[model samples]
Target: MLVVGAVVLAALMLPGVWHLLRHGLTIVHEAAHAGVAVLVGRRLSGIRVHSDTSGLTVSRGRARGPGMVATVAAGYPGPALLGAAAAWLLSRGYALGVLWLLLLVVVLVLLQIRNWYGLWAVLVSGVALVAVTLWAPAQVQTVVAAGLTWFFLLGAPRAVVEMQVQRRRVRRRGGRDESDAGLLAGLTHVPAIVWVGAFLAVCGVLLAAGGAWLLAAWPVTGITYPPWADVPTCDPMCPSAASATAPGLPFSVCDSEAVSTPPEIEPHSGRNESLSLRRALALLDVCARETDPTGLTAAEIGRRLGVHKSTVLRLAAPLLESELLRRDTTSGRFRLGPGALRLGHAYLSTLDVESVAAPSLDELARTTGCLTVLTVPDGLQSRIAGHRPAPGTAGRAVPRLPSVVPLHCTAPGKAILSVAGTALLERAVAGGLRPVTPRSITDPGELRAEVLRTRRRGFAVDDREFDPDVRAVAAPVLDHTGDVVAALAVVGPAARMSAAAVQEHARSVVLAARTVTRRLGGAGLGPSAAAGGAAEDLRARRGA
Candidate 1:
C-alpha cells in the first residue's frame, strides 16, 4: 500500500520536476551569451530571468558593424552545442556531474529565450511546475502524469521545429554556416531519415521510461516506500530473488553524480593543477588565430576548455589586465588587445608586407579598369603599400605616382582616417594638412566632418582632392576586430570618371573591399547590406 502511495505522489510531481530541470538549462544558455559578450568587450546588460528561462544582457553603443553581427549570431549556437557537451559529460560522470548537467540544461533553455514568445513559454511552464510541486493535491498526481506526458509529446516536437527556424534565420543573417546549428540539424540533412528518426525515438523512450518510473513510484495514496525498495530492476521477473529490486531506483540515482566522484585522497591535486594551466595556454593559442572575439563568452570558453565559466574567468584575468585581450566598453565584447597587436606586428615584420597585398590589388585594378593602390596608415599620413596599373590603358597613359599624402586629401587615406576617430584626425591636422592641390581640404574642422560622414557610409571618395584630374573612390579594409587597418582605392581621370560613373562603381569598390576583407578573415557588412548586395549581384550575374 505504501509503495503504491509513493508512486502516486511521484506521478503527481512529475511536471514540476521537469520544469525545474529546464530552469537550469536556461541559466547555462544565457551565461554563454554573456560570457562571449564580455570577451568581446561589449557592455554587460542586465540578465532577464524567469523560473524556466533566462537571457544574458548585452548592449552595443557607438561600436556598430560586422563585430555586432557576429555577437548576435553567437547566441543561437551556444546552447545546442553545449547541450550535447553536457549530455556527453553526463554520460561520462565527471566531477560534480549532475550539477554540470543541470548547468548545461539551463544554458540550453536560456539560448532558446530569444523573444517574448519563448520567454512566455518558459515562464508559464516554470509556473506550472512550481504550482504542482507546492500545492498539487494527491488525486492531482494523475493530472501531473498526464500533463508531463503531453508536454513530452508536444513540447519536444515544438522545440525541434523552433530550433530549425532559428537556424535558418541565422543563416539568412550570414552567420557561420549551418555546421554549428547543432546535432538535430546535422541529423536532419542525412539521406536516410534514420538519424533524425532515431533521435526522436530515443527521446520518446526516455520520456516513457521517466514517466513509468514516476508513476510506479508515486501513486494517488499518501503511503511511502523505502528509498532502496524503489530502485529499478532490468529484469522484472527473472527470479523471486530479483523481485527484491526497486521500481523507482533510477529516480533517486543521478548518473552524473556517480561518475564524477573524486578520488579518496584527492590524489595529485598539485599535478592536476598544471592541467588547467596547460589547457588555458592551449585555449589562448586558439583565440590568437581568431580575428574577432566579439562572439566569445566565458561559458563558450568553458565549453572549449572543458571547464567551468568561473575557471575560465580566473584563467583569463591576467590576460585581460595585460591587454592581451581587451573588453569593448560599449558592447562588452572581447578581442585581442595591445599585447596581441605587438606580437602580430613582430610576426609581420618578418614578411614583405606589399608581397601579401600585391595580387589582390592587381585583381582590383583589372576588375575596375582604374589604378588600384593599397595604403597603410603611417603617422599623420598614409604610405602606398601596393599598387597596380589599370587594365587596357597602355604606356601613353598619365603616370600614377605613389606618395605619402595627408589622410584627408586622398580617397584611400580618408577611408583609413575615417575609422581612426577624432583624436587621430587631430594628430594628423597638428602635423599640418598642407594644401596638396587647389581642391585640397586644408581646414581641420571640415576634414573631420567629412571623415565622420565617410565613416557613416563605410567608404570615402576623393574628386581630385589630392591632385586635380585624379578622381578616386576607396573603401576601408578592416581587421578582425573591425578596425580599419588598411585601405583600397581605384583612381582614374576625373573627366572620364563622372560623378554618376563613380557612384555606379561604388558597389564594385565595396565588393572588392569585402573580398579582401574575407581573405584577411575579417567580418564584412551587416546582414541587410550582404542580403541586398547578394540580390543585386544575383541580378547582375544573371544578366551577364
Candidate 2:
C-alpha cells in the first residue's frame, strides 16, 4: 500500500513539475518585458497571456521612441535571469531548482523567439553547469559531506544494480544481454575534464558582460553633461513633468521637477456652464451603458460631443490622470478604467432586488430541472432579471435572461401582465406587440383571452410562442406587499416536456414558487390554489 501510494503521488507530482517548467518561462518573459518598459520610462498598459504559447505587453506609445532602444534589447534578460536564479539555487544546495532551470532552458529553445541567439547562450550556460555537477565526483571533507552526497555518490552504483536486474530479466526471457553492458560502459565514461572546461568558459563570458555593463555606466553617471541628459530637458512643447523618468534615476543631478503656476481669476461663468457639465455627464452615461466605450477614439468622442479634438483632450486630461479612462496604446482606443470598475461594483453590491429574487429562481430550477428565467417589467417591454440553467444541462447554448423579449409572447412577460391586470395588458397592446415568433398571439382578442385565462389559472404557459422548440410555464414572483416584482419560469425543449411531465411537475413547481414568494414576504397562491376539483384527481394519479 505504501509503495502504491508513493507511485500515485509521483504520478500526480510529475505533471505539476512539467507545467511549472513550461509556465515559468512565460512568467519570466513577460516580467522582463514589463521591467524593460518601465526602465525606459514607458508606463505599462497591461500584460496579456493569450495562451500557453503566446503573450504580449502593452505600454505607453512613447516607449517606441528612439531613446528607448533598451526596451527592445531587453528580451534576452528573461532567459539570463532564469539562469542566474538557477545558479543561485544550486549554490544554496537545491536539486529541484537545478531541474527547473534546465526546464526553462528547454522552453526558451522551443519558443524560438526572435532573440534566439541570446537564449541559446543562456541555455548552453545552464547545461554546462549541470554537466559539471554530474561529472565531478564529490570529495568528502567530513562524514556530513558524504551523507549529503548520497544521490550523487551512489547514482552510478544504483544504475549498475538496475542494469544487472534488466540483464537477468532479459536472460530469463531468452532476450539479448547487450543493454546492461552498454549502460555500465556509459556510466564509467570519463567526461569530467570537458565539463570543467565548458563551465569555466561560461563563467568567463558572464563576468566579462557584467564588467562591461558596470564600466559603461560611468560614462552616463560621472559626466556633468551626458548625451541622454539633453533628452530630459523640457520645453514649452514638452511638459516639465515629462522629464521625470522612472524611479531610482539620480534626481539630484537633474533639476527636472516642474513648478506649479497659480491660476488666473476669471469672471463667473453663467448658469449654462452647470447645464453644459450636466449634459456632458449625461452623454458619458449614454456612452458607458449603450455604447462600447472601449472602441471610442479621440476623433469619435469629439464628433459625438460636438467639440474640437483639443477641447476633448482638455476635458479628458483630468479623467486620464485620475484613471477614470484608459487609452490603449496599441489600438489607440479608450475605455473606462479601475475607477469605473469600483463605482460599478459598489452599485451592484448594494442591489436588493436581485438578492430577493435569486433564491426563488434557484429553487425553481432545482425543483423543475429546467431552465428557470426571471424578468422585470421594463416599461411596455420586459427585461430578463436572471436565468438559472437546469442541472446537468449547462453549456447547452441557451440564451441568457435579462434580454428584452416581447411582453405578450413570453411566459414571464404574460405572467407580469396577468397579475398586473387588464390595464397593463391594454397598455402593452397599445404599445405595439410585434410578432416575435410564429406561436406569438398577435391578435388583441386572443391575447386578452390568454391574459384572462392566465389570471384564472394563476400561471401561464408559452408553447413555442416565444421561440420555436422552447416551451415555458411561469408564475409571478411577488414582493413584500404582494405586488408582482418579477416572474419566474421553467423552460425546456418542447419535445421532452410532455403533457404528463408538465402535470407531474406542476404541483412541485407551484409549491416551489409559493415557498419563494412566502420567503420574500408575499401573500400569493400558486397553481395548486386554482386546481379546485382537478387537484384530487392529479394527486391520486401520482399516488400522493
Candidate 3:
C-alpha cells in the first residue's frame, strides 16, 4: 500500500498530471486564507481558484496588521496541516471520519467560489469526494483515504520547494511580483529567504510527522502476533473535553462553537435529544448561509453535515413534512420552504423602522451633502421618524426629529401621499392642503396633478415648497404587500439642488428607499421609470 501510494503521488506530481491535480491544493490554500480572515475579524468578499492552479482570497480589513499577516501566511501551510489532521484521524481507525471531514471542508469552501472555473473546479472536487465516501466499498474507502493522507503529507513540502524555485526565477528576471514568502518578508521586515525557510521548516516537520503516522498504520503481513494489533482505538464520541484534548483529537461530544453549538436543554431531555437538535439546526444554518436559489443537493447536505444521505433523509423528513424544507422536483435539491418564511417574517417584524433606515439616512446625508430623513404617515400628516444632518451641519442647530411636516408640501410628505393611495389623498383634501410657503401647492386640482407626477416617477421632488430656500427628493418605501411604510428623502439648499441635480438626487433617493425596503424584506415600486417625462419635469423646473 505504501509503495502504491508513493507511486501514485509521484505520478500526480509529474508536470502533466500535476497541472490538474494542483487545483485541489490551490483550493485548500485559498480556503485557508479565507478561514483565517474570518477568524481575525476581516469581512471576506470572495475567493477565486484559478485554472492556472493559482488562487486569490479577497477580504476587507486593515491593510497592514497581524491579521493581514496571518491571512497571507496561512496559504502555503494549509494542505500540510490538513494532511497532518487526516493522518491523525486515520491512525485512530477513523478513516471514514477523515473522508467525511474532508467532504465537509470542501463543501464549506465551495460556498466562497467567485468565478465559473472556481465553481466548476470546486464542484468536481466535491463530487469526487462525495462519490468516494458514499458509493465506494468500505475497503476502497479505507485505501483511498490512506492514499490521500499520504499525498497531502508528501505534496505540501514539494509545493513550497517549487515556490522557492519560481520566486528565484522571478527575481532573476527582475520581476517585482511576489510569492507568499515575499509578502511575508515584507510584512515582517524580514528577508524573503527567511520566510521561505520558515515555510519549508514547518512543512517539512508536518510531513515527517504525518509520514510516520501513515507508515505505522500500514498492516503487517504474516503478523497475527504483532503487538500493535492488540491496541484498541477510540473513535471519538469522546464524551469529555479532557479525553478529547488528552492526546490528538480536536473535537468532542463535549461542545461546538458557533450558533451551531447545541443549545441548553432540560437535564431530563437526554444527550441524544440535544445532539439530534443540534444536527437539525446546523443543517438549516448551512442552507440559510448560502444565498443561491438553486439550494443544495442531498449529497451536498450529507457532505456538509458529515452524515450519510440516509441520515439527511431521516432529519429532513420532518422538516419537509412541516414545510420548513422542501425538495425541488426538477433539481432534486433541498431549499427552505414556505414555513421558513414565517420565521423570517417574525424576525423582520421585530425590526424597528427607525433602526432599519438609520444607516441609509447617514449614508445618504454624507453622499448627497444634505439632510436625510425617514418619514412615515400619521393621520393626514407625515412625521420624521429618523433623520441625519449633512456632514458639516451643526449638531445642536438642526431641529430634532420625530417631528411633524405637512403631508402635501414636503418631498417626503408628497412621496407618502402618492403611495398611500386615493383614500389618503381624499383625507388630505378634507384636512386641506395648507401652503407652507408661496411655492407649496394649495389648489386641490393642482395637488392631485402633483400626486400623479410623483406616481409616474418613483420619486417626488419638492421645488422650494416646504421651505423657500430648500428643495428635496423622496421615494416611498413599501412593505411586501405594497403598502407604503415610509419615505426616504434628501433635503438640501435650493442652490445645490439645481434641476440637473434633482434628476441625480431623485435616483439616489429612490435607491436608498429600495435599500431599506430590501433590508426589511419589503418590495418597492418596481424599477424607477424616471428618464423621459422626468426630463420634461426637470426642464419645467428649470423654466420655473
| TM-score against native, each model | 0.35, 0.32, 0.41
What's model 2's lDDT at 408?
95
In candidate 3, which residue pairs clash? none
Model 1 CA lDDT for position 77? 38
TM-score of 2: 0.32
Candidate 2 residue lDDT tens string, 1-544 = 1222234234334645433333334444555666677777887765544333234555675523542444533433343444444333332323333454454544543343334433444455456445543443221111112121221112222223333566668879997544414322334342423323333444345434433332222111111111112112122111244344312112321222222211232124455555444434433432453346466777776665555666556656666677767779888766676876676567546655567668877877787888877778888877887788898776577665547877799888887877664567778888877887765889876676566555544456776777877777776766645577777778888767754455434434444555556556554632333343133323432441
lDDT of 3: 0.73
For residue 322, give model 3's deviation from the true position in Å: 58
Worst 10 residues of 2 by lDDT: 219-228
The numbered model that scores best in TM-score is 3
As for model 3, its CA RMSD to the true structure in angstroms is 27.2
Q: Which consecutive 10 residues in model 1 have the weakest lDDT in total?
A: 252-261
Cα RMSD, model 1: 30.0
Question: Per-residue lDDT tens digits of candidate 1, residues 161-256?
Answer: 444566567768987443223432333443223333443454455545444433322221111111122122121111232223223111211111
Q: How high is the CA lDDT of each candidate model?
A: 0.53, 0.51, 0.73
Ranking by TM-score: 3, 1, 2
Candidate 1 lDDT at 178 equals 38
